[model samples]
Target: MHDSHNSTAARLFETEGTGNPLDVLKRVYGYSAFRGKQQDVVEHVVAGGDAVVLFPTGAGKSLCFQVPALCRNGVGIVVSPLIALMRDQVEALKQLGVRAAALNSSLTRDEAIAVRHSLAAGALDLLYVTPERAVTDAFADMVADTDIALFAIDEAHCVSQWGHDFRPEYRGLGCLASRFPGVPRIALTATADPHTRDDIIKRLGLDRARVFTTSFDRPNIAYEIVERDQPRQQLLRFLSRFKDASGIVYCLSRAKVDDTAEWLNTQGIRALPYHAGMDRALRDAHQDAFLKEERLCLVATVAFGMGIDKPDVRYVAHLDLPGSVEAYYQETGRAGRDGLPSEVWMAYGMADVIQRRRMIDEGGSPEEIKRIERGKLNTLLAICETAGCRRQAILAHFGEAHPGRCGHCDTCLKPVETWDGTEAAIKALAAVYRTGERFGAGHVIDVLMGTINEKTERFGHVDMPVFGAGKDLPPRTWQSVFRQLLAAGLIKVDHSAFGALQLEPEARSVFRRERQVLFRKDRPSSGKAARGTKSATARERSDLAGSDLELFEKLRSQRLAIARDMDVPPYVVFPDTTLIALAKQRPRGFEDLLDVPGIGESKREKYGEAFLAVIDAFEEGGG
Candidate 1:
C-alpha cells in the first residue's frame, strides 16, 4: 500500500448509498433479528448519529455498532481494553464472511503488515484495537485521513476511574470525539451504575449521544453462592455437573490462582492459570488455549477476563469474594453470553467477607473513594446473604425492578430459613465493643464463645462482661452472626487497627434493642447445571443426553481440528450451541445443516460439508 492508498480508502466510506441493517444482520452475521435495544442503537448509528448503550453482558452489545459499520461504508474501529478478546472477535467475524482484522502486540511483523495493507486498501470491514494502541500517534496518523464508518468502545465503563476494572488508557478515548468529528461513536458497557454511566458519557465526550439502557438481567444464568467449606472440594463438585464444558474460575490473588489451577490439573482436569504475575507470553498462551480448546478451565484473577466474547463459557466460579457487586456481576456475566443455560457458582465464607472489608478499608484509595467501594461491597455481601431471590437484589442495585422472585438463584431453588438474629447480633456487637474493637472477627469470635485460648488471655478479653454470654451458641453460628453484622453495616473493619473489628453507629440500635435483625444462615450449596436440552428457538445447548452427548463430543473434536487448521478459535468454526444443535437434529445433509443457529451462508459454504459428512456417518451406523 502506498500513500495514495489512504485517500482511496477514505473515499470508500463517502459513498452516497447505504444498506439496511436488518438485511446485513441476516446476510452477514447469521442472526435474524436484533435483541433488546440493539435494533434501536444500530438504526441510530446507521443514520449517522451517536449513542451510548448499556446492555447486559450476554445481550449482544457488539451488534449495535457492528451492523451499522457494515450498513455504511469504511472500516469500523472497535476500541477495547482486552487484547486477548481481539483475536477471538476478529476470528469470529472472519468466519461470518466479514473482512475483519486486529492490530495489536499479538501479531507478528508479517501479520501486522498484512492487516495494515488491508486497512489502507479499505478491504477491512472491522478493525479491533486496544485503547493504548488506538490513541497512539502512529495509528492515528495512518487512519486520520482514512474514512471511518464508526467507532465502538467496548467495556466503556473503564473510563470511570472508580470502576472495578479501570484502565488509564480508556480515558484517552475522549480523543476519538475530537479526532473523528463526524464519525458515529457508540460507548457500550455491560456493568455501570448510574454514576458510572454518567461518568462514561462525560469522560468519553458522548454527551450528545443517545443513551440506551437495556435490562441488566441474564435469566438463563443461575446464581448460586456457596459458603466456603473445603473450597477445592466444593469446586470439584461444581465442575462435575458441567463436565467437558469450557468455564472460568476466578480467584482473588495470583498465588491462589496458581495453586488452584495446579490443584485442578492434579485432579485430572486440564486447567490453566492466568494472572498479571505470570510471564506475559505464558499468560497470553494460556488465554489463547482457553479460547481455542474445548473443556479447558481457566483459573484466573480479575486481571484475566474483561472482553472475552467466547459464547460457550458454561460456568464461572469465584473462590474468593469480589471487591464490589459490579465486579461480581461483570465477571459472572462472562458465562452464558450466548443465551444458553449457564451458572455462576461462588464459594463465599467469613474469610471472604473479612478480607474484602479489610481490603476496602485499608486500601490506598482516598477515604471518599473507599467509602463508595465499601457501599458496593456491602451490596454484594447482601446478595450472598439474602434469603430472597438473588437476581432481584442484583437488579435492584442496578436501578432495575424485578418484582417476582426469580426461580434461578440458590435462594429461590432452596428457600433459605431466616432466624431472629437480633439477640445474637447484639451479643456479637457487645463482644466486639468490649474487646476494645482492636481485633478481627476471628479473635472476637473466640472471646464471645468463651474459648479461652492464648489470644483471649493475651488480649485480657477473658474477663470482659460479654465474654461467655454467647458461649451457649457454637462458634460457627457466632461466625455467621459476625458476618451478617459486617454485611449489615452494624460493624466495619478498622484500617487503623490493621483490620480490627469496629462498631458503626448502626450497632448502637442493638444495645438499645431498637431495631430487629434477621440473618440467613449461608451454608455450602450448589446449583443444577442446565444440561443442554436441544430446541430450535433458543438455539441453545449444554449438558446433553446419552447419545446426543457422545455425538456432540465428536462434533467438538471435528470443530477443534478445523479451528487448528484455520488458526482460529474453535468457537470461530462453530460454537458449542451450534454443535449441540447439529447433534440433536443429526442434520441429514448440507441443506439440513444450514438450519442450525450460527450456520450462515458463508460459514455453511466454508465448513458445512465436512460437518455434514461427520453427521451422515454418525446417522448411517458408520460408527
Candidate 2:
C-alpha cells in the first residue's frame, strides 16, 4: 500500500495543475469526450464555480468533479455517504494512477495516520470522508491547514428531509459554504424529485450554483412488473431467464429476505441474505462476497443498495413493492451501470399495498411529511398500474417530460390489456360499503365472491344485497378490481381499521356513473411470458456471436483472474463495456489498445501485454 501511494503521489506531482480537463480525462481516465452535462459542470468547477449535478445513474457524475479536482491546485475533498462506496471509488482511482485515500471508521489507526500525513503533505489528489466525519471540528481544522481544491458532496439528496434516504448529518454540510468561502462546492445525486431537489439546494446553500439536470430515463434498463401470484415461483421463473448472472432481489422485510434467500438456495441458485439485523461481521462478509463474486444474488431489504458501486449488476428484482417512486428509481438504478442492456423486475399485489400503507401510517412522522410520503407512494402505484410506458411515468414524476412508448419497458414491448371496469368497480365499492367499510379486503372480497366463510357468517354479510354480486368473476379478478380501485384513488386501505377497504370521495362519482373506472387486465402468472419473448442476456450482447462471444468470455475470465490477484472487484480493472470494445476491435498492440474507450496510459502500461497475449493466442489458433 505504501509503495502504491508513493507511486500515485509521484504521478500527481507530474500532472498537477495541468489545467486541461480533456487532457486529464484522456491521459488519466481514458475517455475521449465528455458525456451529457459533464463538460459544462467540469468547466464550471475548473473555473472555480459551484454546481449542483442531477444526472441519473451511469451518467458519469464522478468525472464532473474528478477531472476538475485533477486540473485544480489542491486536493479535492469528496463527502461520501457510505464507507463501501468511498472504498470502491478510492480503489478505482488508485487503479487509474490517481492519488486517492478515504478517511472512514473502516480504516485502522495506522492507516488513518498515513492518510492524514499524505493529506498534510499535499501528496493526495482526492480524499473521501463521510458527512459525520467531515463535520467534526478536528477534521475541519485539519482541512484548514491543507490546500483544498474543491468540496464535492456525493449523494447530495441525503441532505433533504423529503428524500428517500435522508441523513441528518448532511445538514451540517451547509457550513462548508461559510467556512471555506472561495473553494468551489458541487452537490451530486442521481435521484431527487422536485420537492427534494429544492430542499437539497436550500439546505446545502447552493442556491447560486448552476444546476445541471439530465434526463431521468435509463433507456438501457427494461422495466417489467407483474401480479404477485405464487411469488417464489414467479421469482424462480424470472431467475431462470437470467441464469448465472449477477443481480439483486429486494424484499420488504428481514424475515422475507432470509426466507427468500434460503428458498432460492434450495432451488439451486447462489443466494445470500443481507439486512440490518444480521451480525455486523456477517453482514460485511455477505456484502464483500456480493461485490467480489461474479454470479451471486444478494437478497436483502431496503437496508442494502444505498451506496453500492458494483457496475455489472445485470438485474434488480423486487419481491414486494417499494415505498415510493424515488426509492424504486434509486434501487433499480443500481443495475446496468455499464450502459449495457439490463432489467428491473417487480412482483406486486394488493397485500403489498396494504402493508406499505400500514407502515407509513403507523410510523412516527409529522402529518405533513406523512402526507407527502403517501403522495409519493401513490405515484409509484400509478406507475405499476399504468398501461402506458413505465419510463414515461417515471420521468414525469421527476418533472421531466418523456413521450410515451419508450419501446424498452414492458408496456411498449407488449402492450397491456385494459378493460372498462366501471361496473366491477362499483360492485367492489358496494361490497365495502355494505360490509360497513370496517372489514379488510379478504372479508369484503369474500362477500363479493359469495363465499360463505365463518367471518362472513359472523358478520351476517351473507344477507347483504352486494353479496354474490361478483360471483361470476374469479377471486383473482376481483382482487385486481380492488387493487386498481385503490391505485386509482377510488378507494384506499384504512390501516387504522386493520386494512379495511374504504371508498374515497371519488368513489361517489363512480357509483353515480358520472366517472368510469378502467383497470389493467391481469395477465396469467406464467413468468416465462412475464417479460417479452426475448431474453435480456441474449439481447445484451447481440452484436457478438460465435467466435466473438467466445473471445468475450475469455476476456472476462482473464479479468476475473487479475482482479482476484489484486483483491479488487472485476470492474475496477475494466468494465464489461471496455472488454466488449476490446473483443470487437481485437487490438493487437499497445498503441491500438489505447484506442479502446476505457484504456488509459496507466492501464495500457500495466495490463496491455497480458491482454495482447490472450488476443494473440486466440488469433494464432483460428482460421
Candidate 3:
C-alpha cells in the first residue's frame, strides 16, 4: 500500500511524525499556508488514516484531500454528488498542473471510456465519480483492482436519512470500506449538525475515523432577513449593489424560478432559470453559463447549488424560507469563497411560514421524523423573528457559541424593538378553538379583526366572542401573532384539516396567562425598506474604482472572447478571482502575472501572454 501510494516523491508524507505536504500545497494549489486544521488533515490522510472533516465553507477542505492525493502516486477516487462540482474542481486542478478527470453522466460515452482507460493504465492523480457509479459492479471491480490512494466522500451528510439532501445512492458508499479494507476513507461535509454527523459516521462505516471540526462562523457573509413586502421590488433593490456580479436567487418552486428569471431579465439583469424539471441538457447549459459568464444570475430551485464551486458568487437571495438552518447555511455558504464580502438575503412572508409548516406535516416521514423536522423549522423561524443577532442565533443552532453580537447581520446593525404579545396570543388561540379549529391562520386573524367576509359569515365565525375583541391591531400585527404562535408550538398546523390551525394541548398554560409571549416589534412596514448592500470589502475585479474598474471590464470582455473561442466556460479559462487580481495589480509581464494569486505555472504557460497583453495595452494607452 505504501509503495503504491507515494507520489513519485522518494518519501511518503506522514500523518504522525513529519512530511512536506505544505510544499505540495504551495507548488500546486498556490496556497502558502494551511488554514485551521487543513495541515493536520493532510498529514493524517497522506499518512494513511481515515478522517471525518467538518470544516466550514471557504475553510480550504479541498486541500485536505487534494494535497494527499497529489502526494500519493495512485489516483484518489473521489465520490462527489454533482457533475458541475466535479467539473469545476477538475478545471481548477488542471490549472494547477494536476492530472484530474471526471466520469459522470454528462460525459460522452467516448469521454467516459477514455477516463476508464486512463484509470486502468494508472495515468491520473484524481478520478471523480458519483456514488451511483461507484456502486456499479463493473466499476466496483475496477476500483477493487486499482492501486487506490484512498477514497473521499464529499457532501457526506447526504448519507443521513434525516438530512435535506439525502440521496439513496449514497447509502451504498459504506461498501467501499468493506471492499477495500486497507484503503483509507475520508467523509467531508460543510453542513452537518451533531445528529447528521453521527449518521454520517454510522452510514459510511467510519467508526474509527478521526473527526476534525473547524469553526462554523463565516464572517465574510453579511446576513439579512426581510419581511416579504412587494417581494420582486425588494429583491431588485437588494440586488442593485450587486449589479454586474454573479449570484443565485433561489425560489421554492420550479415555475417560480422560471417566472423570476424572466422577470429579472426584463429588469436588465442577466438571469437564467434552472430546476430539475428542465431538460438535463438545458439545466446543464444554464448552470455552465452561470459559472462561465460574468454578471449572470441563476434563478433556480433547491435543485441547484450544493455542488457549485464558484468562488466569486457575491450574493444568495432566498425568495422563500428554507425548511432548516442547515439547508440555508449550506446554500448560502456558496458565496465569497475567495474571502471577499458577500451577502445572504432572504425575503419571507406569512405564506412562506405556513407553507413550510404544512409541508412538514404532509411529508411521508414517520411521526418522529416529522417532529424533528418541525423543530428545525421552528428554530429557523426563531432566527427570523428574534430581536437578537441573526448570525449568533445561526451559529448557536450548530452547537457553537458566539458571546457578543456579530455586527454583520441585519438585527445587529439595526436593533429590533420588542413588545409583549401575550394578550394577543391568547386571543389568537381562542379564535382558533372557538372556530372549531377548522380554519388557517389567515381566516383566524380575519375573524379576530371583525372582518365580515363571506367565509366568516358562512362559517358563523362572526358571532364568536373573540370577533372584534382584537380589532385594535392591524392585519400585519395579527399575522405576526399567528406566526409567533406557530413558531412557539402553541398552535399546530393540521395538514389534513385543509391547513387549519389547532391549539396545542400544552398551550393551556399560555392561554391562562401563565406564559408571557414577547414579540420583536417589527420594523415599520412603510415606503421603501433599506437593504444592507456591502459596497466595500474585498473588491471583486469589477468593483474597482476609476481606471481599474474600466480595465476590469475590458479584461472580462477579453476573457469571454477567449472562452467563446475555446468553447469553454470563462471560469474554465480563469475564474473571477483571478481576473480581479489581474485588474487590481495590472501584471506587466509573465513574472508579474505568475505573481498574481491564481496563476499557477501551468496556467501561466498556457494563457498568461494574452492576459499580460491586455494589461500592457492599457498601460501604453494611458501614456
Candidate 4:
C-alpha cells in the first residue's frame, strides 16, 4: 500500500504543471480549491516569501505550508514542539503519499540514522524536528550541507512569553533567520492574542513576513457554560448525548482527572486519565489510546491537547474555569476540527473563581505579568457571565468583531434572564466589609443570612449592622451575585488572606448608589437542558437518512479496520467528512471516487477499491 501510494505521488509530480499549487491541491490532496487565505499564503511561500498564518484549528493551516513545500524546491524543514504532534502529522502526510519524516527523541538510533540518510539523499519532502534538536550545532551543520527549502514553524505562539503555552526552547529558534537568511519561513498557530502575536513576530524574527489573520470564530462549535451544581452529574448529562463519540473532559487537577475517569468508567463510559504528573509511559499509552479509540473520553489537564491532530473530537467539556480567554479558546477549539458541528461545555462556580484567582496570586510570576493575567482572567469571567452571545464575547476578546447573536451558542439558543442586581451587589459588598474583609464568600454569606455558624460567632457576636442584611434572598441567588461581582471587578479575592472577599475600588460607586448593576438570573439545573436539544449526529449527517446513515457506519467500520491493519489512526485513512460524502454519493468506481472531497490520487489508487466494495455490498443487500 505504501509503495502504491508513493508511486501515485511520483506520477502526480511527473505530470504537466507539477509545481502548480492548484494542480497539487486537486491531484495530491484531492481538494478542488483553497479556502480563505490559503491560496495567497501558498503562493507567497511558493514564490520564496516569508509569512505568518493565524488560521483557526480546522482552517487548513497545514496545507498553507504543505502545498507550498510540495511546490518549491528541496525539503521543507518543520519545527514542531511535541513528539506526538510530529508523529501524527508525519503519518498523515505519508498517507497522502508525501515523503515525510520526523527527528525526535522517540526514534530509535537506526531509525534516526535512516531519517538523516533520507534527508542527505533529498528523498524526503518534509522533515519535522523539535526546537531543542533544530537549534543544536550538529543539526544546523547537517542542514547547512543539504539543499534546503523554507522553514515552517508550527505552534509559533510558543515563542512568545505572553502565549499561554510558551516554551523556552522556542527562544533559540530566533537564530533561524540569521542562519538561513534567504529561506522563506512561515509561522502558524490557531490561538494568539494581540500581545502574543506581536511577541511571536518579534521573537521569531518574522518582522517582514506577511501576517494573515483569519477570523477566530468557530461557528461549528456550540459554546455552553453552566453554573457548577453537581458538576459530575452535569458532565454526565452532557456526555449522555455523545455516548458513542470521542471527546475530552478537562479538569484543573490531577486528582480530579483520575477520579473523573474512574467514575466515568463505573458509569459505563470508556475514559482514561492524563496529566503531567502521570508516569510518562502511562501518559503516552493513554494518549495513544485516545487517538485510536472511537468511543472514549480522556479526562485530562491542559497538558493533553497542545497539538492534537485528531479531527473527529465531538466535544470538549471543562469541569473548572480556565485561566484566561486565550486558554479557553485554544482548549475548546480542539473539538470538531473537521468543520462539522460540535459542542464545548463548561461548568464553573464561585469556588472555581476563588481557586483560579488564588493560583494566579500565589504564583511566582512578576507583578506585571500577574496583573495582565488577572486582567485576562477577568475578561473570561465576563464572557461566562454575559447574557448576550457567547460567541460574540469570545471573538471580541481576540479583537475579531462578530455580529451579535451567532444563533449557535447557549445564549442565542435560550436567552438568559437578567435582574436589577444593584441592591444585591451593595449588600454583598457590605457583608464582606462588615466581616473585616478577611472571610471568604461562605463566611460572608453566613453573616449576611444570619446563620449563627461557629466561625461567624467566633469572628463576631453576630450582632454587626450588616448581619441578616441579605436574609430575603436564597443562598444560591447570593452566590450568583458574588460570582458576578468578582467577574465584574467590583470585588476581588485576597489570596494572601486565604481566599477572602474584598471590595475593589469600583465597588465604591455601587455602594454610593451611583452605579447600577445587572446580573443574569441563575437558571435551575435541568438535565434535559444540559443534554442539548439537537441530535448529536444531526449536524454531521443532517442530509443522510435511512440507508445512507447505515452506509456511513459501514464505511467508518471499513476505515477503522484498514487503519488498525496499518497501525494508524482511523482519520488517517479518511476523515468522517469524506466518509459522509462517500455514503451520500455512493460513488461506483475510481473515477467517481476521485470526485469525493478527500480522495487524492494516492488514496484513490490505494483504498478506492475497498470503499467501492463496501458501497457495492450495500447496494447488493450484503451491508
Candidate 5:
C-alpha cells in the first residue's frame, strides 16, 4: 500500500489498504466511490506520505483526510482554523462511530483534561485542534511520544501572508514536522492562487510534498456580476429567487451589514447581521441561529463566514467587490457544499472599486497600496467583464487553464456579444477631461446623456463637444466600457487632482489611434437565459407538473425507508446526484446500476440485490 518514489504514489494506497477501503466507503460514508481524488489522496496519507491538496468547495475535500484518519494506524492530528469547524467535524465523525475529539479554548478545564486523557489512552482515532492549541508544549510532547500516523493541516492557505485570510500563527506549524519527523503531513486548502500556493508551501516547509489539485471549478454555481446601481433592489430580486432558502449576503462595512439585514427583515426574509462591531453575544447567537435553523440567511461583512460547514447554503451574494480573487473564491465557494445547485451573484461598480483602493491606500505604503489596488481592481474587473466562462476565469486567475466554457456559468448559458467601443471610450474619456475631471461617474454620466437636470446645467456641462456623443449607446454600456478601461489601465483616477481623470501610459495608444476598445452588450432575456442565470434545478423542482413530481416523491419515500433500515442518511444512501443520475439513466439491472456514479463494488454487493430488484419491479410495472 506504500510507495515512496513514484509520483503516482497516491494511487497505490487506494488498491492496498487494510482491506478494500471501498467496502468501508459504501457502508460507512454511504457512497459508492470517493469524489475526485479523495480515494487516492486518502491512500497517500494512510501510506505515510506528505501531500498538499487543493479541492474546490463541495468537492468532498474533508473525506480525503477523514477516511484515511480512520484507516491509518495510531491517531491522526488535524490542525484546523475555527472552533466551529473543529466542533462540527468531531460531531460528524462521532455520529459515524469514529473516535474523534476536539481540543480548543472553547472547552472547560476538565473537558480539556478528559480529551488529553483520551488521547493518552489511545481512545481516539482523530484529534482536532486549532493551530494555536497545537503549538503548545504539551501537544508537542504528546506528538513526540505518540506514534501519530498523520498530521493534517486544514485550511492551510492561512499559512500564507499572501492569502486572503492570513494568520501569523499558521506560519509556526512547520514545527510539527520538526517535533515528529516520521509522521506524514497533508495540507489542504480550498482556495489559493499560484503566489499564495507557493507561499503556503514555503511557510509550511512542505517542499518535498506531492501536490494533488482537483480542479478548482464549481460547475454547479451560476456566477453573475452586475453593476451596483440600486444594489438594495438588486439584492431583493436575488433573495426573491431563494424565497426562504439558506444563503449569505456579504457586505464590506458593519453598518452596511446591519442596514442590509434590517432591510431584508422588512422584506420578510428571516435574516441576521454579523460583524466584528456587534456585541459578542449577539454575534455568537446570530451565528448559532443561522447554523441550527433552516432557511435563515445571514448578511455579514468580510469578518464572517470562514470555516462554515453548512452543506446546503443555496446561494452567496456579495454586495461589493472582494479585495482579491482568492477572497472572492473562498467567500463564494461557501455555497453549494453539498454539490447541489447554487448561486454566486455579485454587484460591483466604480464606487466599489474606488472604495477598496482607497482603503488599501490608507493602510499601506504608496507602493504597497498600488500593488494591492492593481490586484484588486484586476480581480473586480475580471468578475465584471470576463467574456469567457466565469469558472474558467476564476481558475485561470489561480494559474490553472480551463479547457473551455464550464457549461454552467451565465456567460456559457447566454453568451455576451461584444462590440467595438473605441469611439464611445474616446468620447467618455473626452467628456471626463472636458468637464475638468472634477466629478464622479454620476455627474459625468449626466453630461454624456445631455441630461437637462440642475446638476448638469449647474456646471454648464451639457454644452461640451463630448456631451451627448455617447448617447448612441446606453449609459449602462458606457459604464461597463469605462470600468473595463480603468481596469485595463487606459485611464487612471487622480484623487490628488480633485478626483480628476488622467490618461494612463496605455491611454496613449488610444490617443495615438494604436489601440481599439471593445465592450459587451446586454443580451435579450429568454427562458433558457433566465433559467440558466440562477438555480434552474431548484426552479425545475418547483415548476414540475403534478404527476411527474408526485412519482418522484413516491420513489424518494421508498428510498428513505430503505436508507433508514440500513441506518444512514437518505442522501447518503442515494445522493441527489445519484438519484438524478438514475432518473436520467433509468438503470434496469445491476450492469446499468454499476455504470452510475457513486456506485462501486461494495454498494453492488450489499444493497445492490435489493435496489436492482426494485428497479426491475419498476421497469416491469412500466415505471
Candidate 6:
C-alpha cells in the first residue's frame, strides 16, 4: 500500500492504447451494443471532452462514462449522491477486476485510507464519491493531482437549483474542471426539464460542453391519475391486479407510509415502510430486503430510493400526488424500465393540491414561489381531470409535442364520454356566486344539492335561486362539474385558505349562458375497471415474438442473480432494454456484441462473463 503522503504525480498518466475501447467492452462488461447516444458519449469522454448526458432511468447512462473511464488515461472519478448506490456500484465494478473504490460516510477510517492508497498507487480505474466529499479540499487535491480520465456527475439534476433534490454543496463542483483543466467532465441525470437543464449546465460550468439528450418518453409505462374519492379503498383495488408484483407506494409522510404499509400487509401484501425517520440499521435492512426479496412493496416518502437501480419494478403508485410534474414523471419512469409493461397509478384530491402549493410557497422569493405554485397547480389539474391522453398532456407541459393519443393511458383505453356540461357548469357557477364563493367543494355541493345544513341556513344559501337547481345531479357529478368549471377558468381557488372557491370574471359569462361551457356529462366514476387495466399503449409495444420473450425472461433471471451476487440492483447490471436488444440480436461472439446497443467495454468485461455463460448455456440447451 502506498503512503497517504505520497504524491500522485505518476498517477496522472492516461491508460494509452488501452485497446480498442470496444475491445474493453467485450472484456469488462459483456455488452454487445451501445444504447441510445451511449456510443457518441463514450467516444467524447474517451477523447477527454466535457459532456452533459440526459438519459431516462434504466437507459444505461452509467456506461456512457464508465466505459470511457477505462479507455482514458488514469482513474475516473464518479460523483454520485446516493451513498448506498455508490457503494453497490463500486463493489460490482471491483468484482469485474476493475480497480474500483468508493469514499463515503459508510466507509471506516481504514477503508478510506485504503482507497486513498489505491489512488496514490494508480491501482484504481474508477473512484465513486458523493459531491459533498468530492469537493472537499482533501479529495479535490487528490483528484487534481491524479491522471483523471473522467469526472462523472451521477444524478446530475441535484446540482441544479430547480431540481427537487437541490444541494448547495453541488455548486462547488465547478471547481473540479477549473482545478483540473485537462481532465474530462461528464454530467449525467435520469431526469431534467429544459429549465433544469439550463440550471445544470450553468451550475456545472459546462456551457461549452456537448449535450446528449435521449427521448424522455417511456412508452411501456402508462401514466394515469384518478381523483381521490375513498383513497385507501381505491389503492387496495389498484394493488389487486398486480399481486406479487414488485411495486412502490409513495406517501407524503412517514406516519402515512407506516400506516399504508401496515394496511397493505393486513390485506396480505408483503409491504414495508421506509423513511429517513427510521433507525439507520432498519433503513439499510429494509432497503436490502426490498432489493433481495420478491413481492415486497416499499411504502416511502420522497426521501427513499433516489438513485435506486431496481429495473424490474412493475408499478409505482402514488398515494398522494407529488409536488411537481417533473417529480411525477421521474417517479413513474421508475416502472417499465425493463421495457416491459408497467402502470403508474396515482390518487389526487383537493387537499393534495393545496398541500403541494403550500410546500412550494414555504420558502423562496415571492416571484419564485408564485411561479412554482402556478406550475404545480397546472400540472396537478392537467393530470387529474384532463380527458385527453395523459401522456400527451405531460409531454406538452414539458414543451414536447405528441401528434395524437397515446392509446395507453386509462383515458385513452376507456375513453371518457363528453356531455355539454354547459348547463351543469352554469348551475355550478350560479351556486358559487349565490353562496359568495367562499365555501369549499363540500359546502358548495351542499348548497347545490339544497341540503339544509346549518352553515347553508346561516348564509341563507338554501333559499337562493340556484340552491336546488342542481339537486337532481349526483354528488360525484356535481364534483366533476366544479372541477370542469375550474378547468374552464370560470372559477379560481384562493391558495391562502385551503383553496376556497372564488368566482372568476369569466364565471359571469358562463353563468349567463352567453358562452357555452362544455364539460363531460356522466363522468367516468372510480370502479373496478378504472382501478385495474393494462394500458393499451403497453400492449401494443409488447410485440416481441415468443422466442424473444423466452430469451428475455431467461436473460433477466440470470441478470438478477448476478446483480444479487454482486450486491447491486439488477438494472445496473443490465437494463431490461439491453436484455431485450440482446435477446433480439443474439450476438454470436464478442465482435458481434459490439454492434448491440448499450454494450460498452467496461460493462462488457464486468458483466460479460456471467451473461455470456447464461447465453451459451441457453443456446446449447435448445434456447
RMSD of each: 5.5, 2.9, 5.0, 2.4, 7.3, 6.0
Summarize candidate 5's per-residue lDDT along 379-410 as a digit string, tens digits.
75766776767787788887888886767777
What's model 4's TM-score? 0.96
List where candidate 6 sits over 4 angstroms from the true fold: 1-19, 362-367, 487-490, 504-516, 521-526, 530-623
Candidate 5: clashing pairs of residues: none
User: Model 5: runs farther than 4 Å from truth?
Assistant: 1-20, 365-373, 431-439, 442-477, 494-500, 522-529, 532-623
Error of 1 at 264 (Å): 1.9
Pairs that collide in candidate 3 are none
> Each model's TM-score, in the order given?
0.91, 0.96, 0.92, 0.96, 0.81, 0.85
Sliding window of 10 residues with minimal summed lDDT for model 5: 1-10
Model 5: number of clashes?
0
The 0-to-1 C-alpha lDDT of every candidate, in the order given, reads 0.82, 0.89, 0.83, 0.89, 0.74, 0.76
Clashing pairs in 4: none
Question: Against the true structure, candidate 4 has what lDDT?
Answer: 0.89
Question: Could you tell me how far off, in angstroms, the CA of residue 141 lies in candidate 4 after the best superposition?
Answer: 0.2
Q: Of 5 and 6, which scores higher on lDDT?
A: 6
**What's the C-alpha lDDT at position 537 in model 2?**
67
Count of clashes in candidate 4: 0
Residue-wise C-alpha lDDT for candidate 4, range 1-623, written one tens digit per residue: 11223323354554321499998898788889999999999999998999999988999999999988888888899999999999999999888888899999999999999999999987888999999998898998988877677899999989987877879999999999898889899999998999899999999889999999899889889999999888889888888878678999999999999999999999999999999999999999999999987998999999999889999999999999999998999999999999998999999999888888888889888898889889999999999999999999999988899998888888888899999989889889988887778988888888888899788778773989888988999998989888899889998999998888888999999999999999998877665563355545665788888999999999999999998998888999999999999998888766887789999988887788899888998989955
lDDT against true structure, model 6: 0.76
Q: After superposition, how far is residue 524 of candidate 5 from its true place, in Å?
A: 8.3
Model 5 local distance difference test score: 0.74
